[model samples]
Target chain A: MPDRSVAGPLTDPGPSHPCGGTSPRTGEPDGRPATAPGCNGRVTAPPDDCLARNEWICGAYLSSRRDILWGAVLQHLQLTAVSVLIGLVIAVPLALAARRWRWAAGPVLGVTTILYTVPSLAMFSLLLPVYGLSASLVVAGLVLYSLTLLVRNILAGLRAVPEETRQAARGMGYGPVRLLVAVELPLALPAAMAGLRIATVSAVSLVTIGAIVGYGGLGNLIYSGMNTYFKAQVLTASVLCVVIAVAADLLLLLAQRLLTPWTRRQS
Target chain B: MNILSEAWSWLTTSAHWYGQDGIWTRLAQHLVLTVVCLLISCLIALPVALVLGHLGKGGALAVNISNIGRAVPTFAVLVLLLLTPIGRFGEGPTVVALVLFAVPPLLTNAYVGMREVDQDVVRAARGMGMTGRQMLFQVEVPLALPLIMTGVRIAAVQLVATATIAALAGGGGLGRIITAGFNLASTAQVVAGAVLVAAFALIVEGLFELAQRLAPGRVRGGNTG
Candidate 1:
């Protein structure tokens, strides 16, 4: 709250908004406060000349125009959710196979490891020929990247079920499928959930790179903001990505706690 | 296969391998950026992690804060830095952004590695009247080598991938090749640029794996993440 008159001139909130055509925030005529005498108390607006100066925050994040930001956020979430779900779906079966065959573990882990090492931008560009700049290309790359984390964790979770526990179940005449469903899978859930959390956060960040191919969720805002030198949009988009990633991570943490009561007790 | 051949042909063209905007120059630029940023990140992350791990305090908080930090996209950080006063220094902002992107794994793995050192061995060192500094440098660091190297490997490989954002920020890197290809609408060139980055990352990863294998056998099996 330091001296509004000095700060007022720097940020004018002028009519030069990118969206053009005055919105509700800018449409008000004579926004300057004439009632305040010589920059004293109860200063509502600024002097007339200040309003003509350039605004740091453009119309991109203006209240009336927030739907654009909302749409971008939804796109970001959708990209993350879809890619992570696909990765989880593919990883579970692969993890199970590796657990069973033993030999499958090497190649499965190796291939996914190589894929994970590929840069997100490089992965997207590599698939350009096959996918032709579609959002699916982004999803496809993300799913491949997610595989290593999910598979490793899922396998680790399954392996974590003690041999003694498995022996006890088998002694009870539990079938392989029944033992897996009732015992192993449930025990593996916590680790698998941890993998899911990591994968989801990674996907959220990676989706921003999809902007290069014209499919980034909040990334589009950042790209455009950089090009146009609009600070607000870039800040807004970056903040949103952080919020989404943190929120997704925290929610998954909550889910893990709720789903694995035994783990909490042991801890 | 068709794309591979096209990429190969694009890569081998003499015109693509020379001059300021050539593949070799861009590759050099990308390598320099990656190395410099990696060094800076190691400087910032390692000492902090090592001390915390030695003290056996605040390791979890440091690691968690870094995980949250990771969620901030590199590209976003680059863009934000570019719009600020710091952006005037050209490569400064890009390097800053890359350092931020690479720090978390280095910090986490180093801390985890240090903490994972055998408690009995630590007690033995203490019984022998070794100083804390001596114990940390002589005992813990040697035991932590595999995991520390694993962190370096992860950060190096990630920086190679993440360095592409440099081109967008008016800095030099192999990402310029990809962006140039995109501008020219040449799929072959784009693929070639990507192949180079992927190849570079694989080579870096391989080198780290080799180094990890060369460590003491007991430490070689240490957990990476």
Candidate 2:
């Protein structure tokens, strides 16, 4: 892998990374040749640069890789958001079905649990046959992975709704859908939001695994950087991944508090 | 259907079960990696959680830290370690990343378990003649067993799943089979590799569940004869 990492990025030659081309910000030539002959016939940054030194925290690496980094981050966000949203859409019905039908509870939970345990890599591979080597492969795998968490929490929230609350809504001439939408779902928001937060953060983390199939977003950068032993690229991309996870969690937590203002009044 | 048959044939072939990169060898590597990481993680996490839980202090800090730790991607940690000075050593980076990965759940679960032990029970033990150590080892631990067991079970299953990252870092494991099959574009082999790993993980999860069930009634709490 180490040997391949060194040779891997060199072979791409796609000008994807701005380090070897004109700066996106300045639109000026980089002055030096796009790529210099690296040690052992590999293509590397121009001599005497931070990259040439292979430094771990090079600012130059960040500035040069900005476009690439931004693209990866966007892709990462897209993957996480799409999958988690789809998971929620699917989970709502599963949760409701599980609530409404006694028999569905076991099978829904059972299938999702099994899906959750299959592992990120194997999950993707299993879906490869279905989605092939596309971004949907990653999204589909993530949606499946999110199911167990989403379904369980949604079901728990629904179950916690008091029978009295349902009866009261029913007595008011509320239809079944109205009772669920107005009465039940509002009460269930805290738990569902909690599940959503976890699902989102985990999706952020797992999106990187998509790099293997070329849909990894930040994972693609991390994988290639590690291969070439590109320290700054590895660290920067990783820190960004963590930041995204934290930010997503915090945002969801805030949303939960706002949506379930009553929950804040409690201990 | 064709892929399934191909994967099935691959699994049944005696040729795939022997040699350097064989299923047996990869499974052993994967298991060894998982066990070693779990041991190290348990050693580091359990005592801290137990003590913090027992003292009823610093537990919030520990739990908060573990929650933060959960948000960091395991893959990032793996690659970062590989790019650092630690990457030079054989499996050192993988071991370090996995140990770090396994710690949070173990710490959080165990700590929460200890804290959630009924306060009345602790008060009664204090009211009795039992020492602090006796309370922790006997009464408190017994009461906390179910939650602690849940934590350990979660950690073990997670380790089994995440240890596959080892192959990406040039370490050994069943992940190599998947990566290898991937490189060769052999979908059958990839499916077979996925099956091997998925099955291994399920077995591990089942075994942990069984262990928890079969544990002495004392460790299971309040059910002792």
Candidate 3:
């Protein structure tokens, strides 16, 4: 509720007029002991030195920190993309194995479920000693978290291919791997896509937790903003994260539509 | 090897288990936060979802809107709340953030569960001279119990995991141990704290799984038509 109200007008830029007021100590360069005029008490002018480094208004902050922000966004995208991709690669084989060997499904799903349930913060800290605050630590945790969803969905998709279809494929002299790739994988696209959407968004979110170890995407901006009490920086970074998540989700939905036009027509 | 040995030593150190900052105290605090948030989220989300489900109108919109809550990071919400005036009160901001985070699954599952109940069964109950309330409670609810329980289980596990964020916002929880470890640069202590949180989540997951199994026979392990 508070987040909604706070973030609601993030893109409006109507507050830019108020932030233009000259900071009190701008002449002294330190900008110390000054209140930013006109802007709701949401922000205080950082020391002029800090202000020079980081812009004040939301728009200016975007432009001023564009390089850093873009880098963070790219990093964020990379983190989510790489983690989900890796998870998908691992999950497909595991799901296939589970399908072929029923006994393995239980233990495999159980292990992933446990990994998924581990709190992100705890998982990160648990690996700190072994990985020493590296991106690999975050990626490992994220990949594990994505496993439950990815594997379940892939299996569901593969299973959702009617038994008759599998039987028909076999009757056509298709071998196991060929049948899987040519027949099963195409049919399983929708479910797998759905899983991808969820995993990507979730990874985007979990990647922010990596900020604790100083590897977060927009999360770094959020942490800095909180520490410095810069409302613009915090709001901007948070908004961008939500934006990225929604965009990624929508793109996947479109891909699903393109891949499964039959489902769309039926719907 | 050194890390494991250090972790074991840190965990075994009895002094870490007592006092205000001890593992026991933080664990209790974490449990309390999680349970309280879960209860509050259920109270807020369940009735609305159930009633909407029973009515079979406007439920889709409610569920979709709540999905947006899932998209937003709980950590971002927590930080945003702490910036607002409500952050002044003890535990208020953390509770609000956690409750918001816990809502979407509970709301979605409860609604879907109710909707998934057999229509013929509802009609049968009504034919037997049952009041709407009676039909809802005696027929629909029992059928929907499994899914409703599933939602609760999900919310419970999620709350247990996310409650660790409370320490970041100055609220008490097991996360304090991790943060303290970070401050002290004691990797063993951090690992120990992480183990505690992860173990607690697994235990909660296990308890909920047991509860699901222990549901009434008619409602257990059977899909509603």
Query: Can you tell me which runs of candidate 1 are displaced by over 4 Å?
Result: A1-60, B216-225
Task: Please give the DockQ score of every candidate, comma-separated.
Answer: 0.45, 0.57, 0.47
Ranking by TM-score: 2, 3, 1
Q: What residue pairs clash in candidate 1, if any at all?
A: none
Model 1 agreement with the true structure over A91-164: per-residue lDDT tens digits: 99999999999899999999999998888878888898889778899899899999999999999999999999
CAPRI verdict (incorrect, acceptable, medium, high) for model 1: acceptable
RMSD of each: 7.4, 4.8, 6.3
- Which candidate do you rate higher for DockQ, 1 or 3? 3
Question: For all candidates listed, what's the TM-score of chain B alone?
Answer: 0.92, 0.94, 0.95
The CAPRI classification for model 2 reads as medium
Question: Cα lDDT for residue B37, model 3?
Answer: 93
- Candidate 3 CA-lDDT value: 0.79
Write down the worst ten-residue block by lDDT for model 3 chain A: A2-11
Top candidate by DockQ? 2
What's the distance in Å from true for residue B180, model 1?
1.3
